[model samples]
Target: MLITGADLAAPALALLDDYEVVFAGKAPSPDDIVALCRRHDPVAIIVRYGKVGAAAMDAAPSLRVISKHGSGTDTIDKAAAAARGIQVVAAAGANAAAVAEHAMALLLACAKSVAVLNERMHAGHWDKATHKSMELEGRTVGLVGLGAIGLRVARMADAMGMRVLAFDPYAKDVPPFVQRVELDAIWRESDVISLHCPLTADNAGLLSAATLAACKPGVIVVNTARGGLIDEPALLAAIRSGQVAGAGLDSFAEEPMTPAHPFHGEPRITLSPHVAGVTADAYVKMGVGAARNALAVLHG
Candidate 1:
């Protein structure tokens, strides 16, 4: 067994005690991961973070399963795994509350300009508090996906007196509080837009310059999903033009290397190191889930 990209703590990882669980360091690129597979020929690959492409699949001759640490498997190529009879499983809904809470925190921080205000205070400037801050109460929030995390966010927004408009073509049994609306309607009416969708070929670059232009001016965007879901250049431009009031982003095209990131100095965006679903509680659940999934595939 091999664990790549991120840490999987001892307790849950102990489930694979019968096998050798190797941790190949952190922040390795897709090619690096494939090279590791070429050398190790691990029976199972637990992709906690980063990509597992066709080349990686080709490199793993002994691979029987590919287990994802979290809900979204966008970074792993499903087709490549399928071609080699590799079973791919993910720990869905295990980290829903953690991700939902992080999204809400981002929303609140942006609404209150927490990032900007804190910097101002540290810089010895104190006049910004008098400025108006947007409140969640009574504002319409559009959620791009209605998965477990999205549903959790919907429930939380309801408690805060915010209307939730969710768009999910395949979603069913949506609660009465959330209005299932078309994607265009969300762009037209939402004061805040939150993304909870996985990255797919059809939805990659979903929030491009054209779509951002269609959105209500000064709309606040919060994305905890894939970075490719939003065009970084377009988002940066929108922020500069004030078309986007602010953004709370937990993912990026390039991440875990924040010092040279473009969003590092941008006050209009509140950034996180993709740790939204990495709470202590979620980590255990994800690790145990991945271990069981891999063992199931190996035994079957």
Candidate 2:
């Protein structure tokens, strides 16, 4: 059997229909995943939203492959899959443009207070127009990562006439337009800071309280990466204290944030339902890539 931990685009699932495909159903909790896998004994598991760990892997002796719907493998217990000889594949760079564009959308939204102004305009208020909005040109943008998505963001930032500073120990052959800099300079000088790195044990809370404290006053932050990169409680405290002026967050420490979540009521935060990489074009690419990976493992 083939199984999908979360819903995939119809096209991708259609490719696997030659086999007995099963759905893990909606918003499955961790326990639900183990039960679903054990019940189905899926040979191939495509994990989009659910966590696949040692328990789920151990449940299925026939499990042959595990495919991540996107680039990150932090959600999957990779070591466990390897121990059981299950091939793991990811659709890297499939959504780089979509994610980079979403990061820019968040940056522009925060800089201009576009959402706030639109709401005010609808309320028949024009007082906000008298106040100055933040400008993008000539300001400095510090990037925390320089991978495919981050590189794309760098190009866009340069096109906007902004000086780009970056911190990526793994990156080389630095572009002339992007000045590779240290972390200290990023926090000390940049007006805008964005994160585009993957989540790992070494840097889980890289943007913790101490890091935030070092940022320039009223610094705007945009996170298009994993939610675990920042400590949500500490971030909320900083926002409440007004040290971090505004945030554009596409991911969160927790998914499916409740309506009454504190971030929802904060005016300085702009939220999206983690759709940064879910544009129609990227969605199709990811779906097809994941489907093809599963088929290769199953047939080979």
Candidate 3:
């Protein structure tokens, strides 16, 4: 067994007691993973972070399975793994609560300008007389996915008295409060839009300039899913032009966003370093899930 990151939860580590586990450091480039694969010839890989591609797959003739630490498997090359007869699996829903709560926090922050207010207060200024926050009640929120995390977010929005509209062609058993609708309805009618879908070839840049333009003016955008789903430049421009009133983002097109990134000084944007699912409880759950999944394939 080989782990892609420096650490895995101790409980998960216990599951691989019979195998020698190798760590690829905190941040590994593609070459690092390929080198480690060639050297260790690990039979299974638990991906905590970084991409797993064809080069790494070819390096490890003994590799049997690639398990994801979280729900999203976009970082792994599924086609390459399948071609080589290597199985791919994800710890789906392990981080649902953690990520759902973070999405809600981002939405609330954007709607209420929470970060802006905090900065203003710390700078010895109060805008109580001039500031007004958008009320969520009775407003429509459009969700792009209805998986575990999306379902939790829908329930949260419903509890707040917000009308929830969702677009997920494959979703079933949707709650009564959520109205299943087409993607066009989501764009045309929502006061707020939240994304909880995986990044796929078909939906990459789903929220492009044209799609952003179709949204209701002053709409709030929240994304806790893959960053590639939205065009970064288009989102930046939308915020600037007020096509998007505010944005709360937990992921980005690039990880470890550069200090000089365009969003750095943008006041209307709330940013988190894609750690929405990194809570202590979630870390353990995801790690355990990944370990179990890898073991299942290997033992079978």
Candidate 4:
């Protein structure tokens, strides 16, 4: 089996002792990935999502399965893989709890204005009076999607004395502490809103400027899910104008945000480099699951 991205090599090597492994030096382009796959002609290909494309599938006619190192498959061309009779498997649920913890961390940071206040203290400015923070206790937290991560966030928020309101069309029932509401109710009533939905065509740019206009003023927003779910430009405008009090973002529309990014200058925003689910524990679980899935396909 071949691993196409360097980030996955360490984890793959640790968990996949039974397999003969080959590593690509870096994330290869479509053509390079195809050429490499063709040269190896391995029965199973273990790839990091967003690095492999249709060309890789086209290049390896003998490839039976593609094992994803993570959950998201946006980087992979599912249609092409299906057309080629290739099975695609991901380490689903392996990183859910870790990601849920990160989401809650963001929410707490935003509610407390932790980043901005810390910077003020470092600059020798006594801004405690100006940085009056909101308490999570007795506040309403709205969860946009009640999936694995959302459910976990809801339970945590409830335990912290916050009322949990969740909006998930597919979720018929959640914990008794969580009250399922409509999307508009969440927007109108929530003191803090955390997004936990996947990026799909139907929900892309779900949190746009227009949606921000409808939300309660001084609302804290947290998104550890996907970048495309919230419109970046709209979020910037909201933060600047104080329509949104603060935002904690773990992912952005672009990875490794450029130096000129507007959010970099915003004091009301806390940013992380998409490392929410990239924890050591999450990595091991995902790697082991991917290895098991690969072994299953190889033996079958």
Best by lDDT: 3
Tens-digit lDDT string for candidate 1 (134-218): 9889999999999999999999999999999999998988999999999999999999999999989999899999989999998
Stretches > 4 Å off in candidate 2? none
Q: Candidate 4 regions off by >4 Å?
A: 7-15
lDDT by residue (tens digit), candidate 3, 51-122: 999999999999999999999999899999999999999999999999999999999999999999999999
Evaluate all candidate structures by whole-model CA lDDT and list the values in order.
0.89, 0.88, 0.96, 0.83
Tens digits of per-residue lDDT for model 4, 228-251: 999999988998899999999998
lDDT of 3 at 197: 94
Off by over 4 Å in 3: none
Over the full model, what C-alpha lDDT does candidate 2 score relative to the true structure?
0.88
TM-score for candidate 1, residues paired by index: 0.94
Cα lDDT for residue 1, candidate 1? 86
Q: What's the TM-score of each model vs. the native?
A: 0.94, 0.93, 0.99, 0.92
- Cα lDDT of model 1 overall? 0.89
Residue 151 accuracy (lDDT) in model 2: 94
RMSD of 2: 1.8
Clashing pairs in 3: none
Candidate 3's displacement at residue 250, Å, is: 0.8
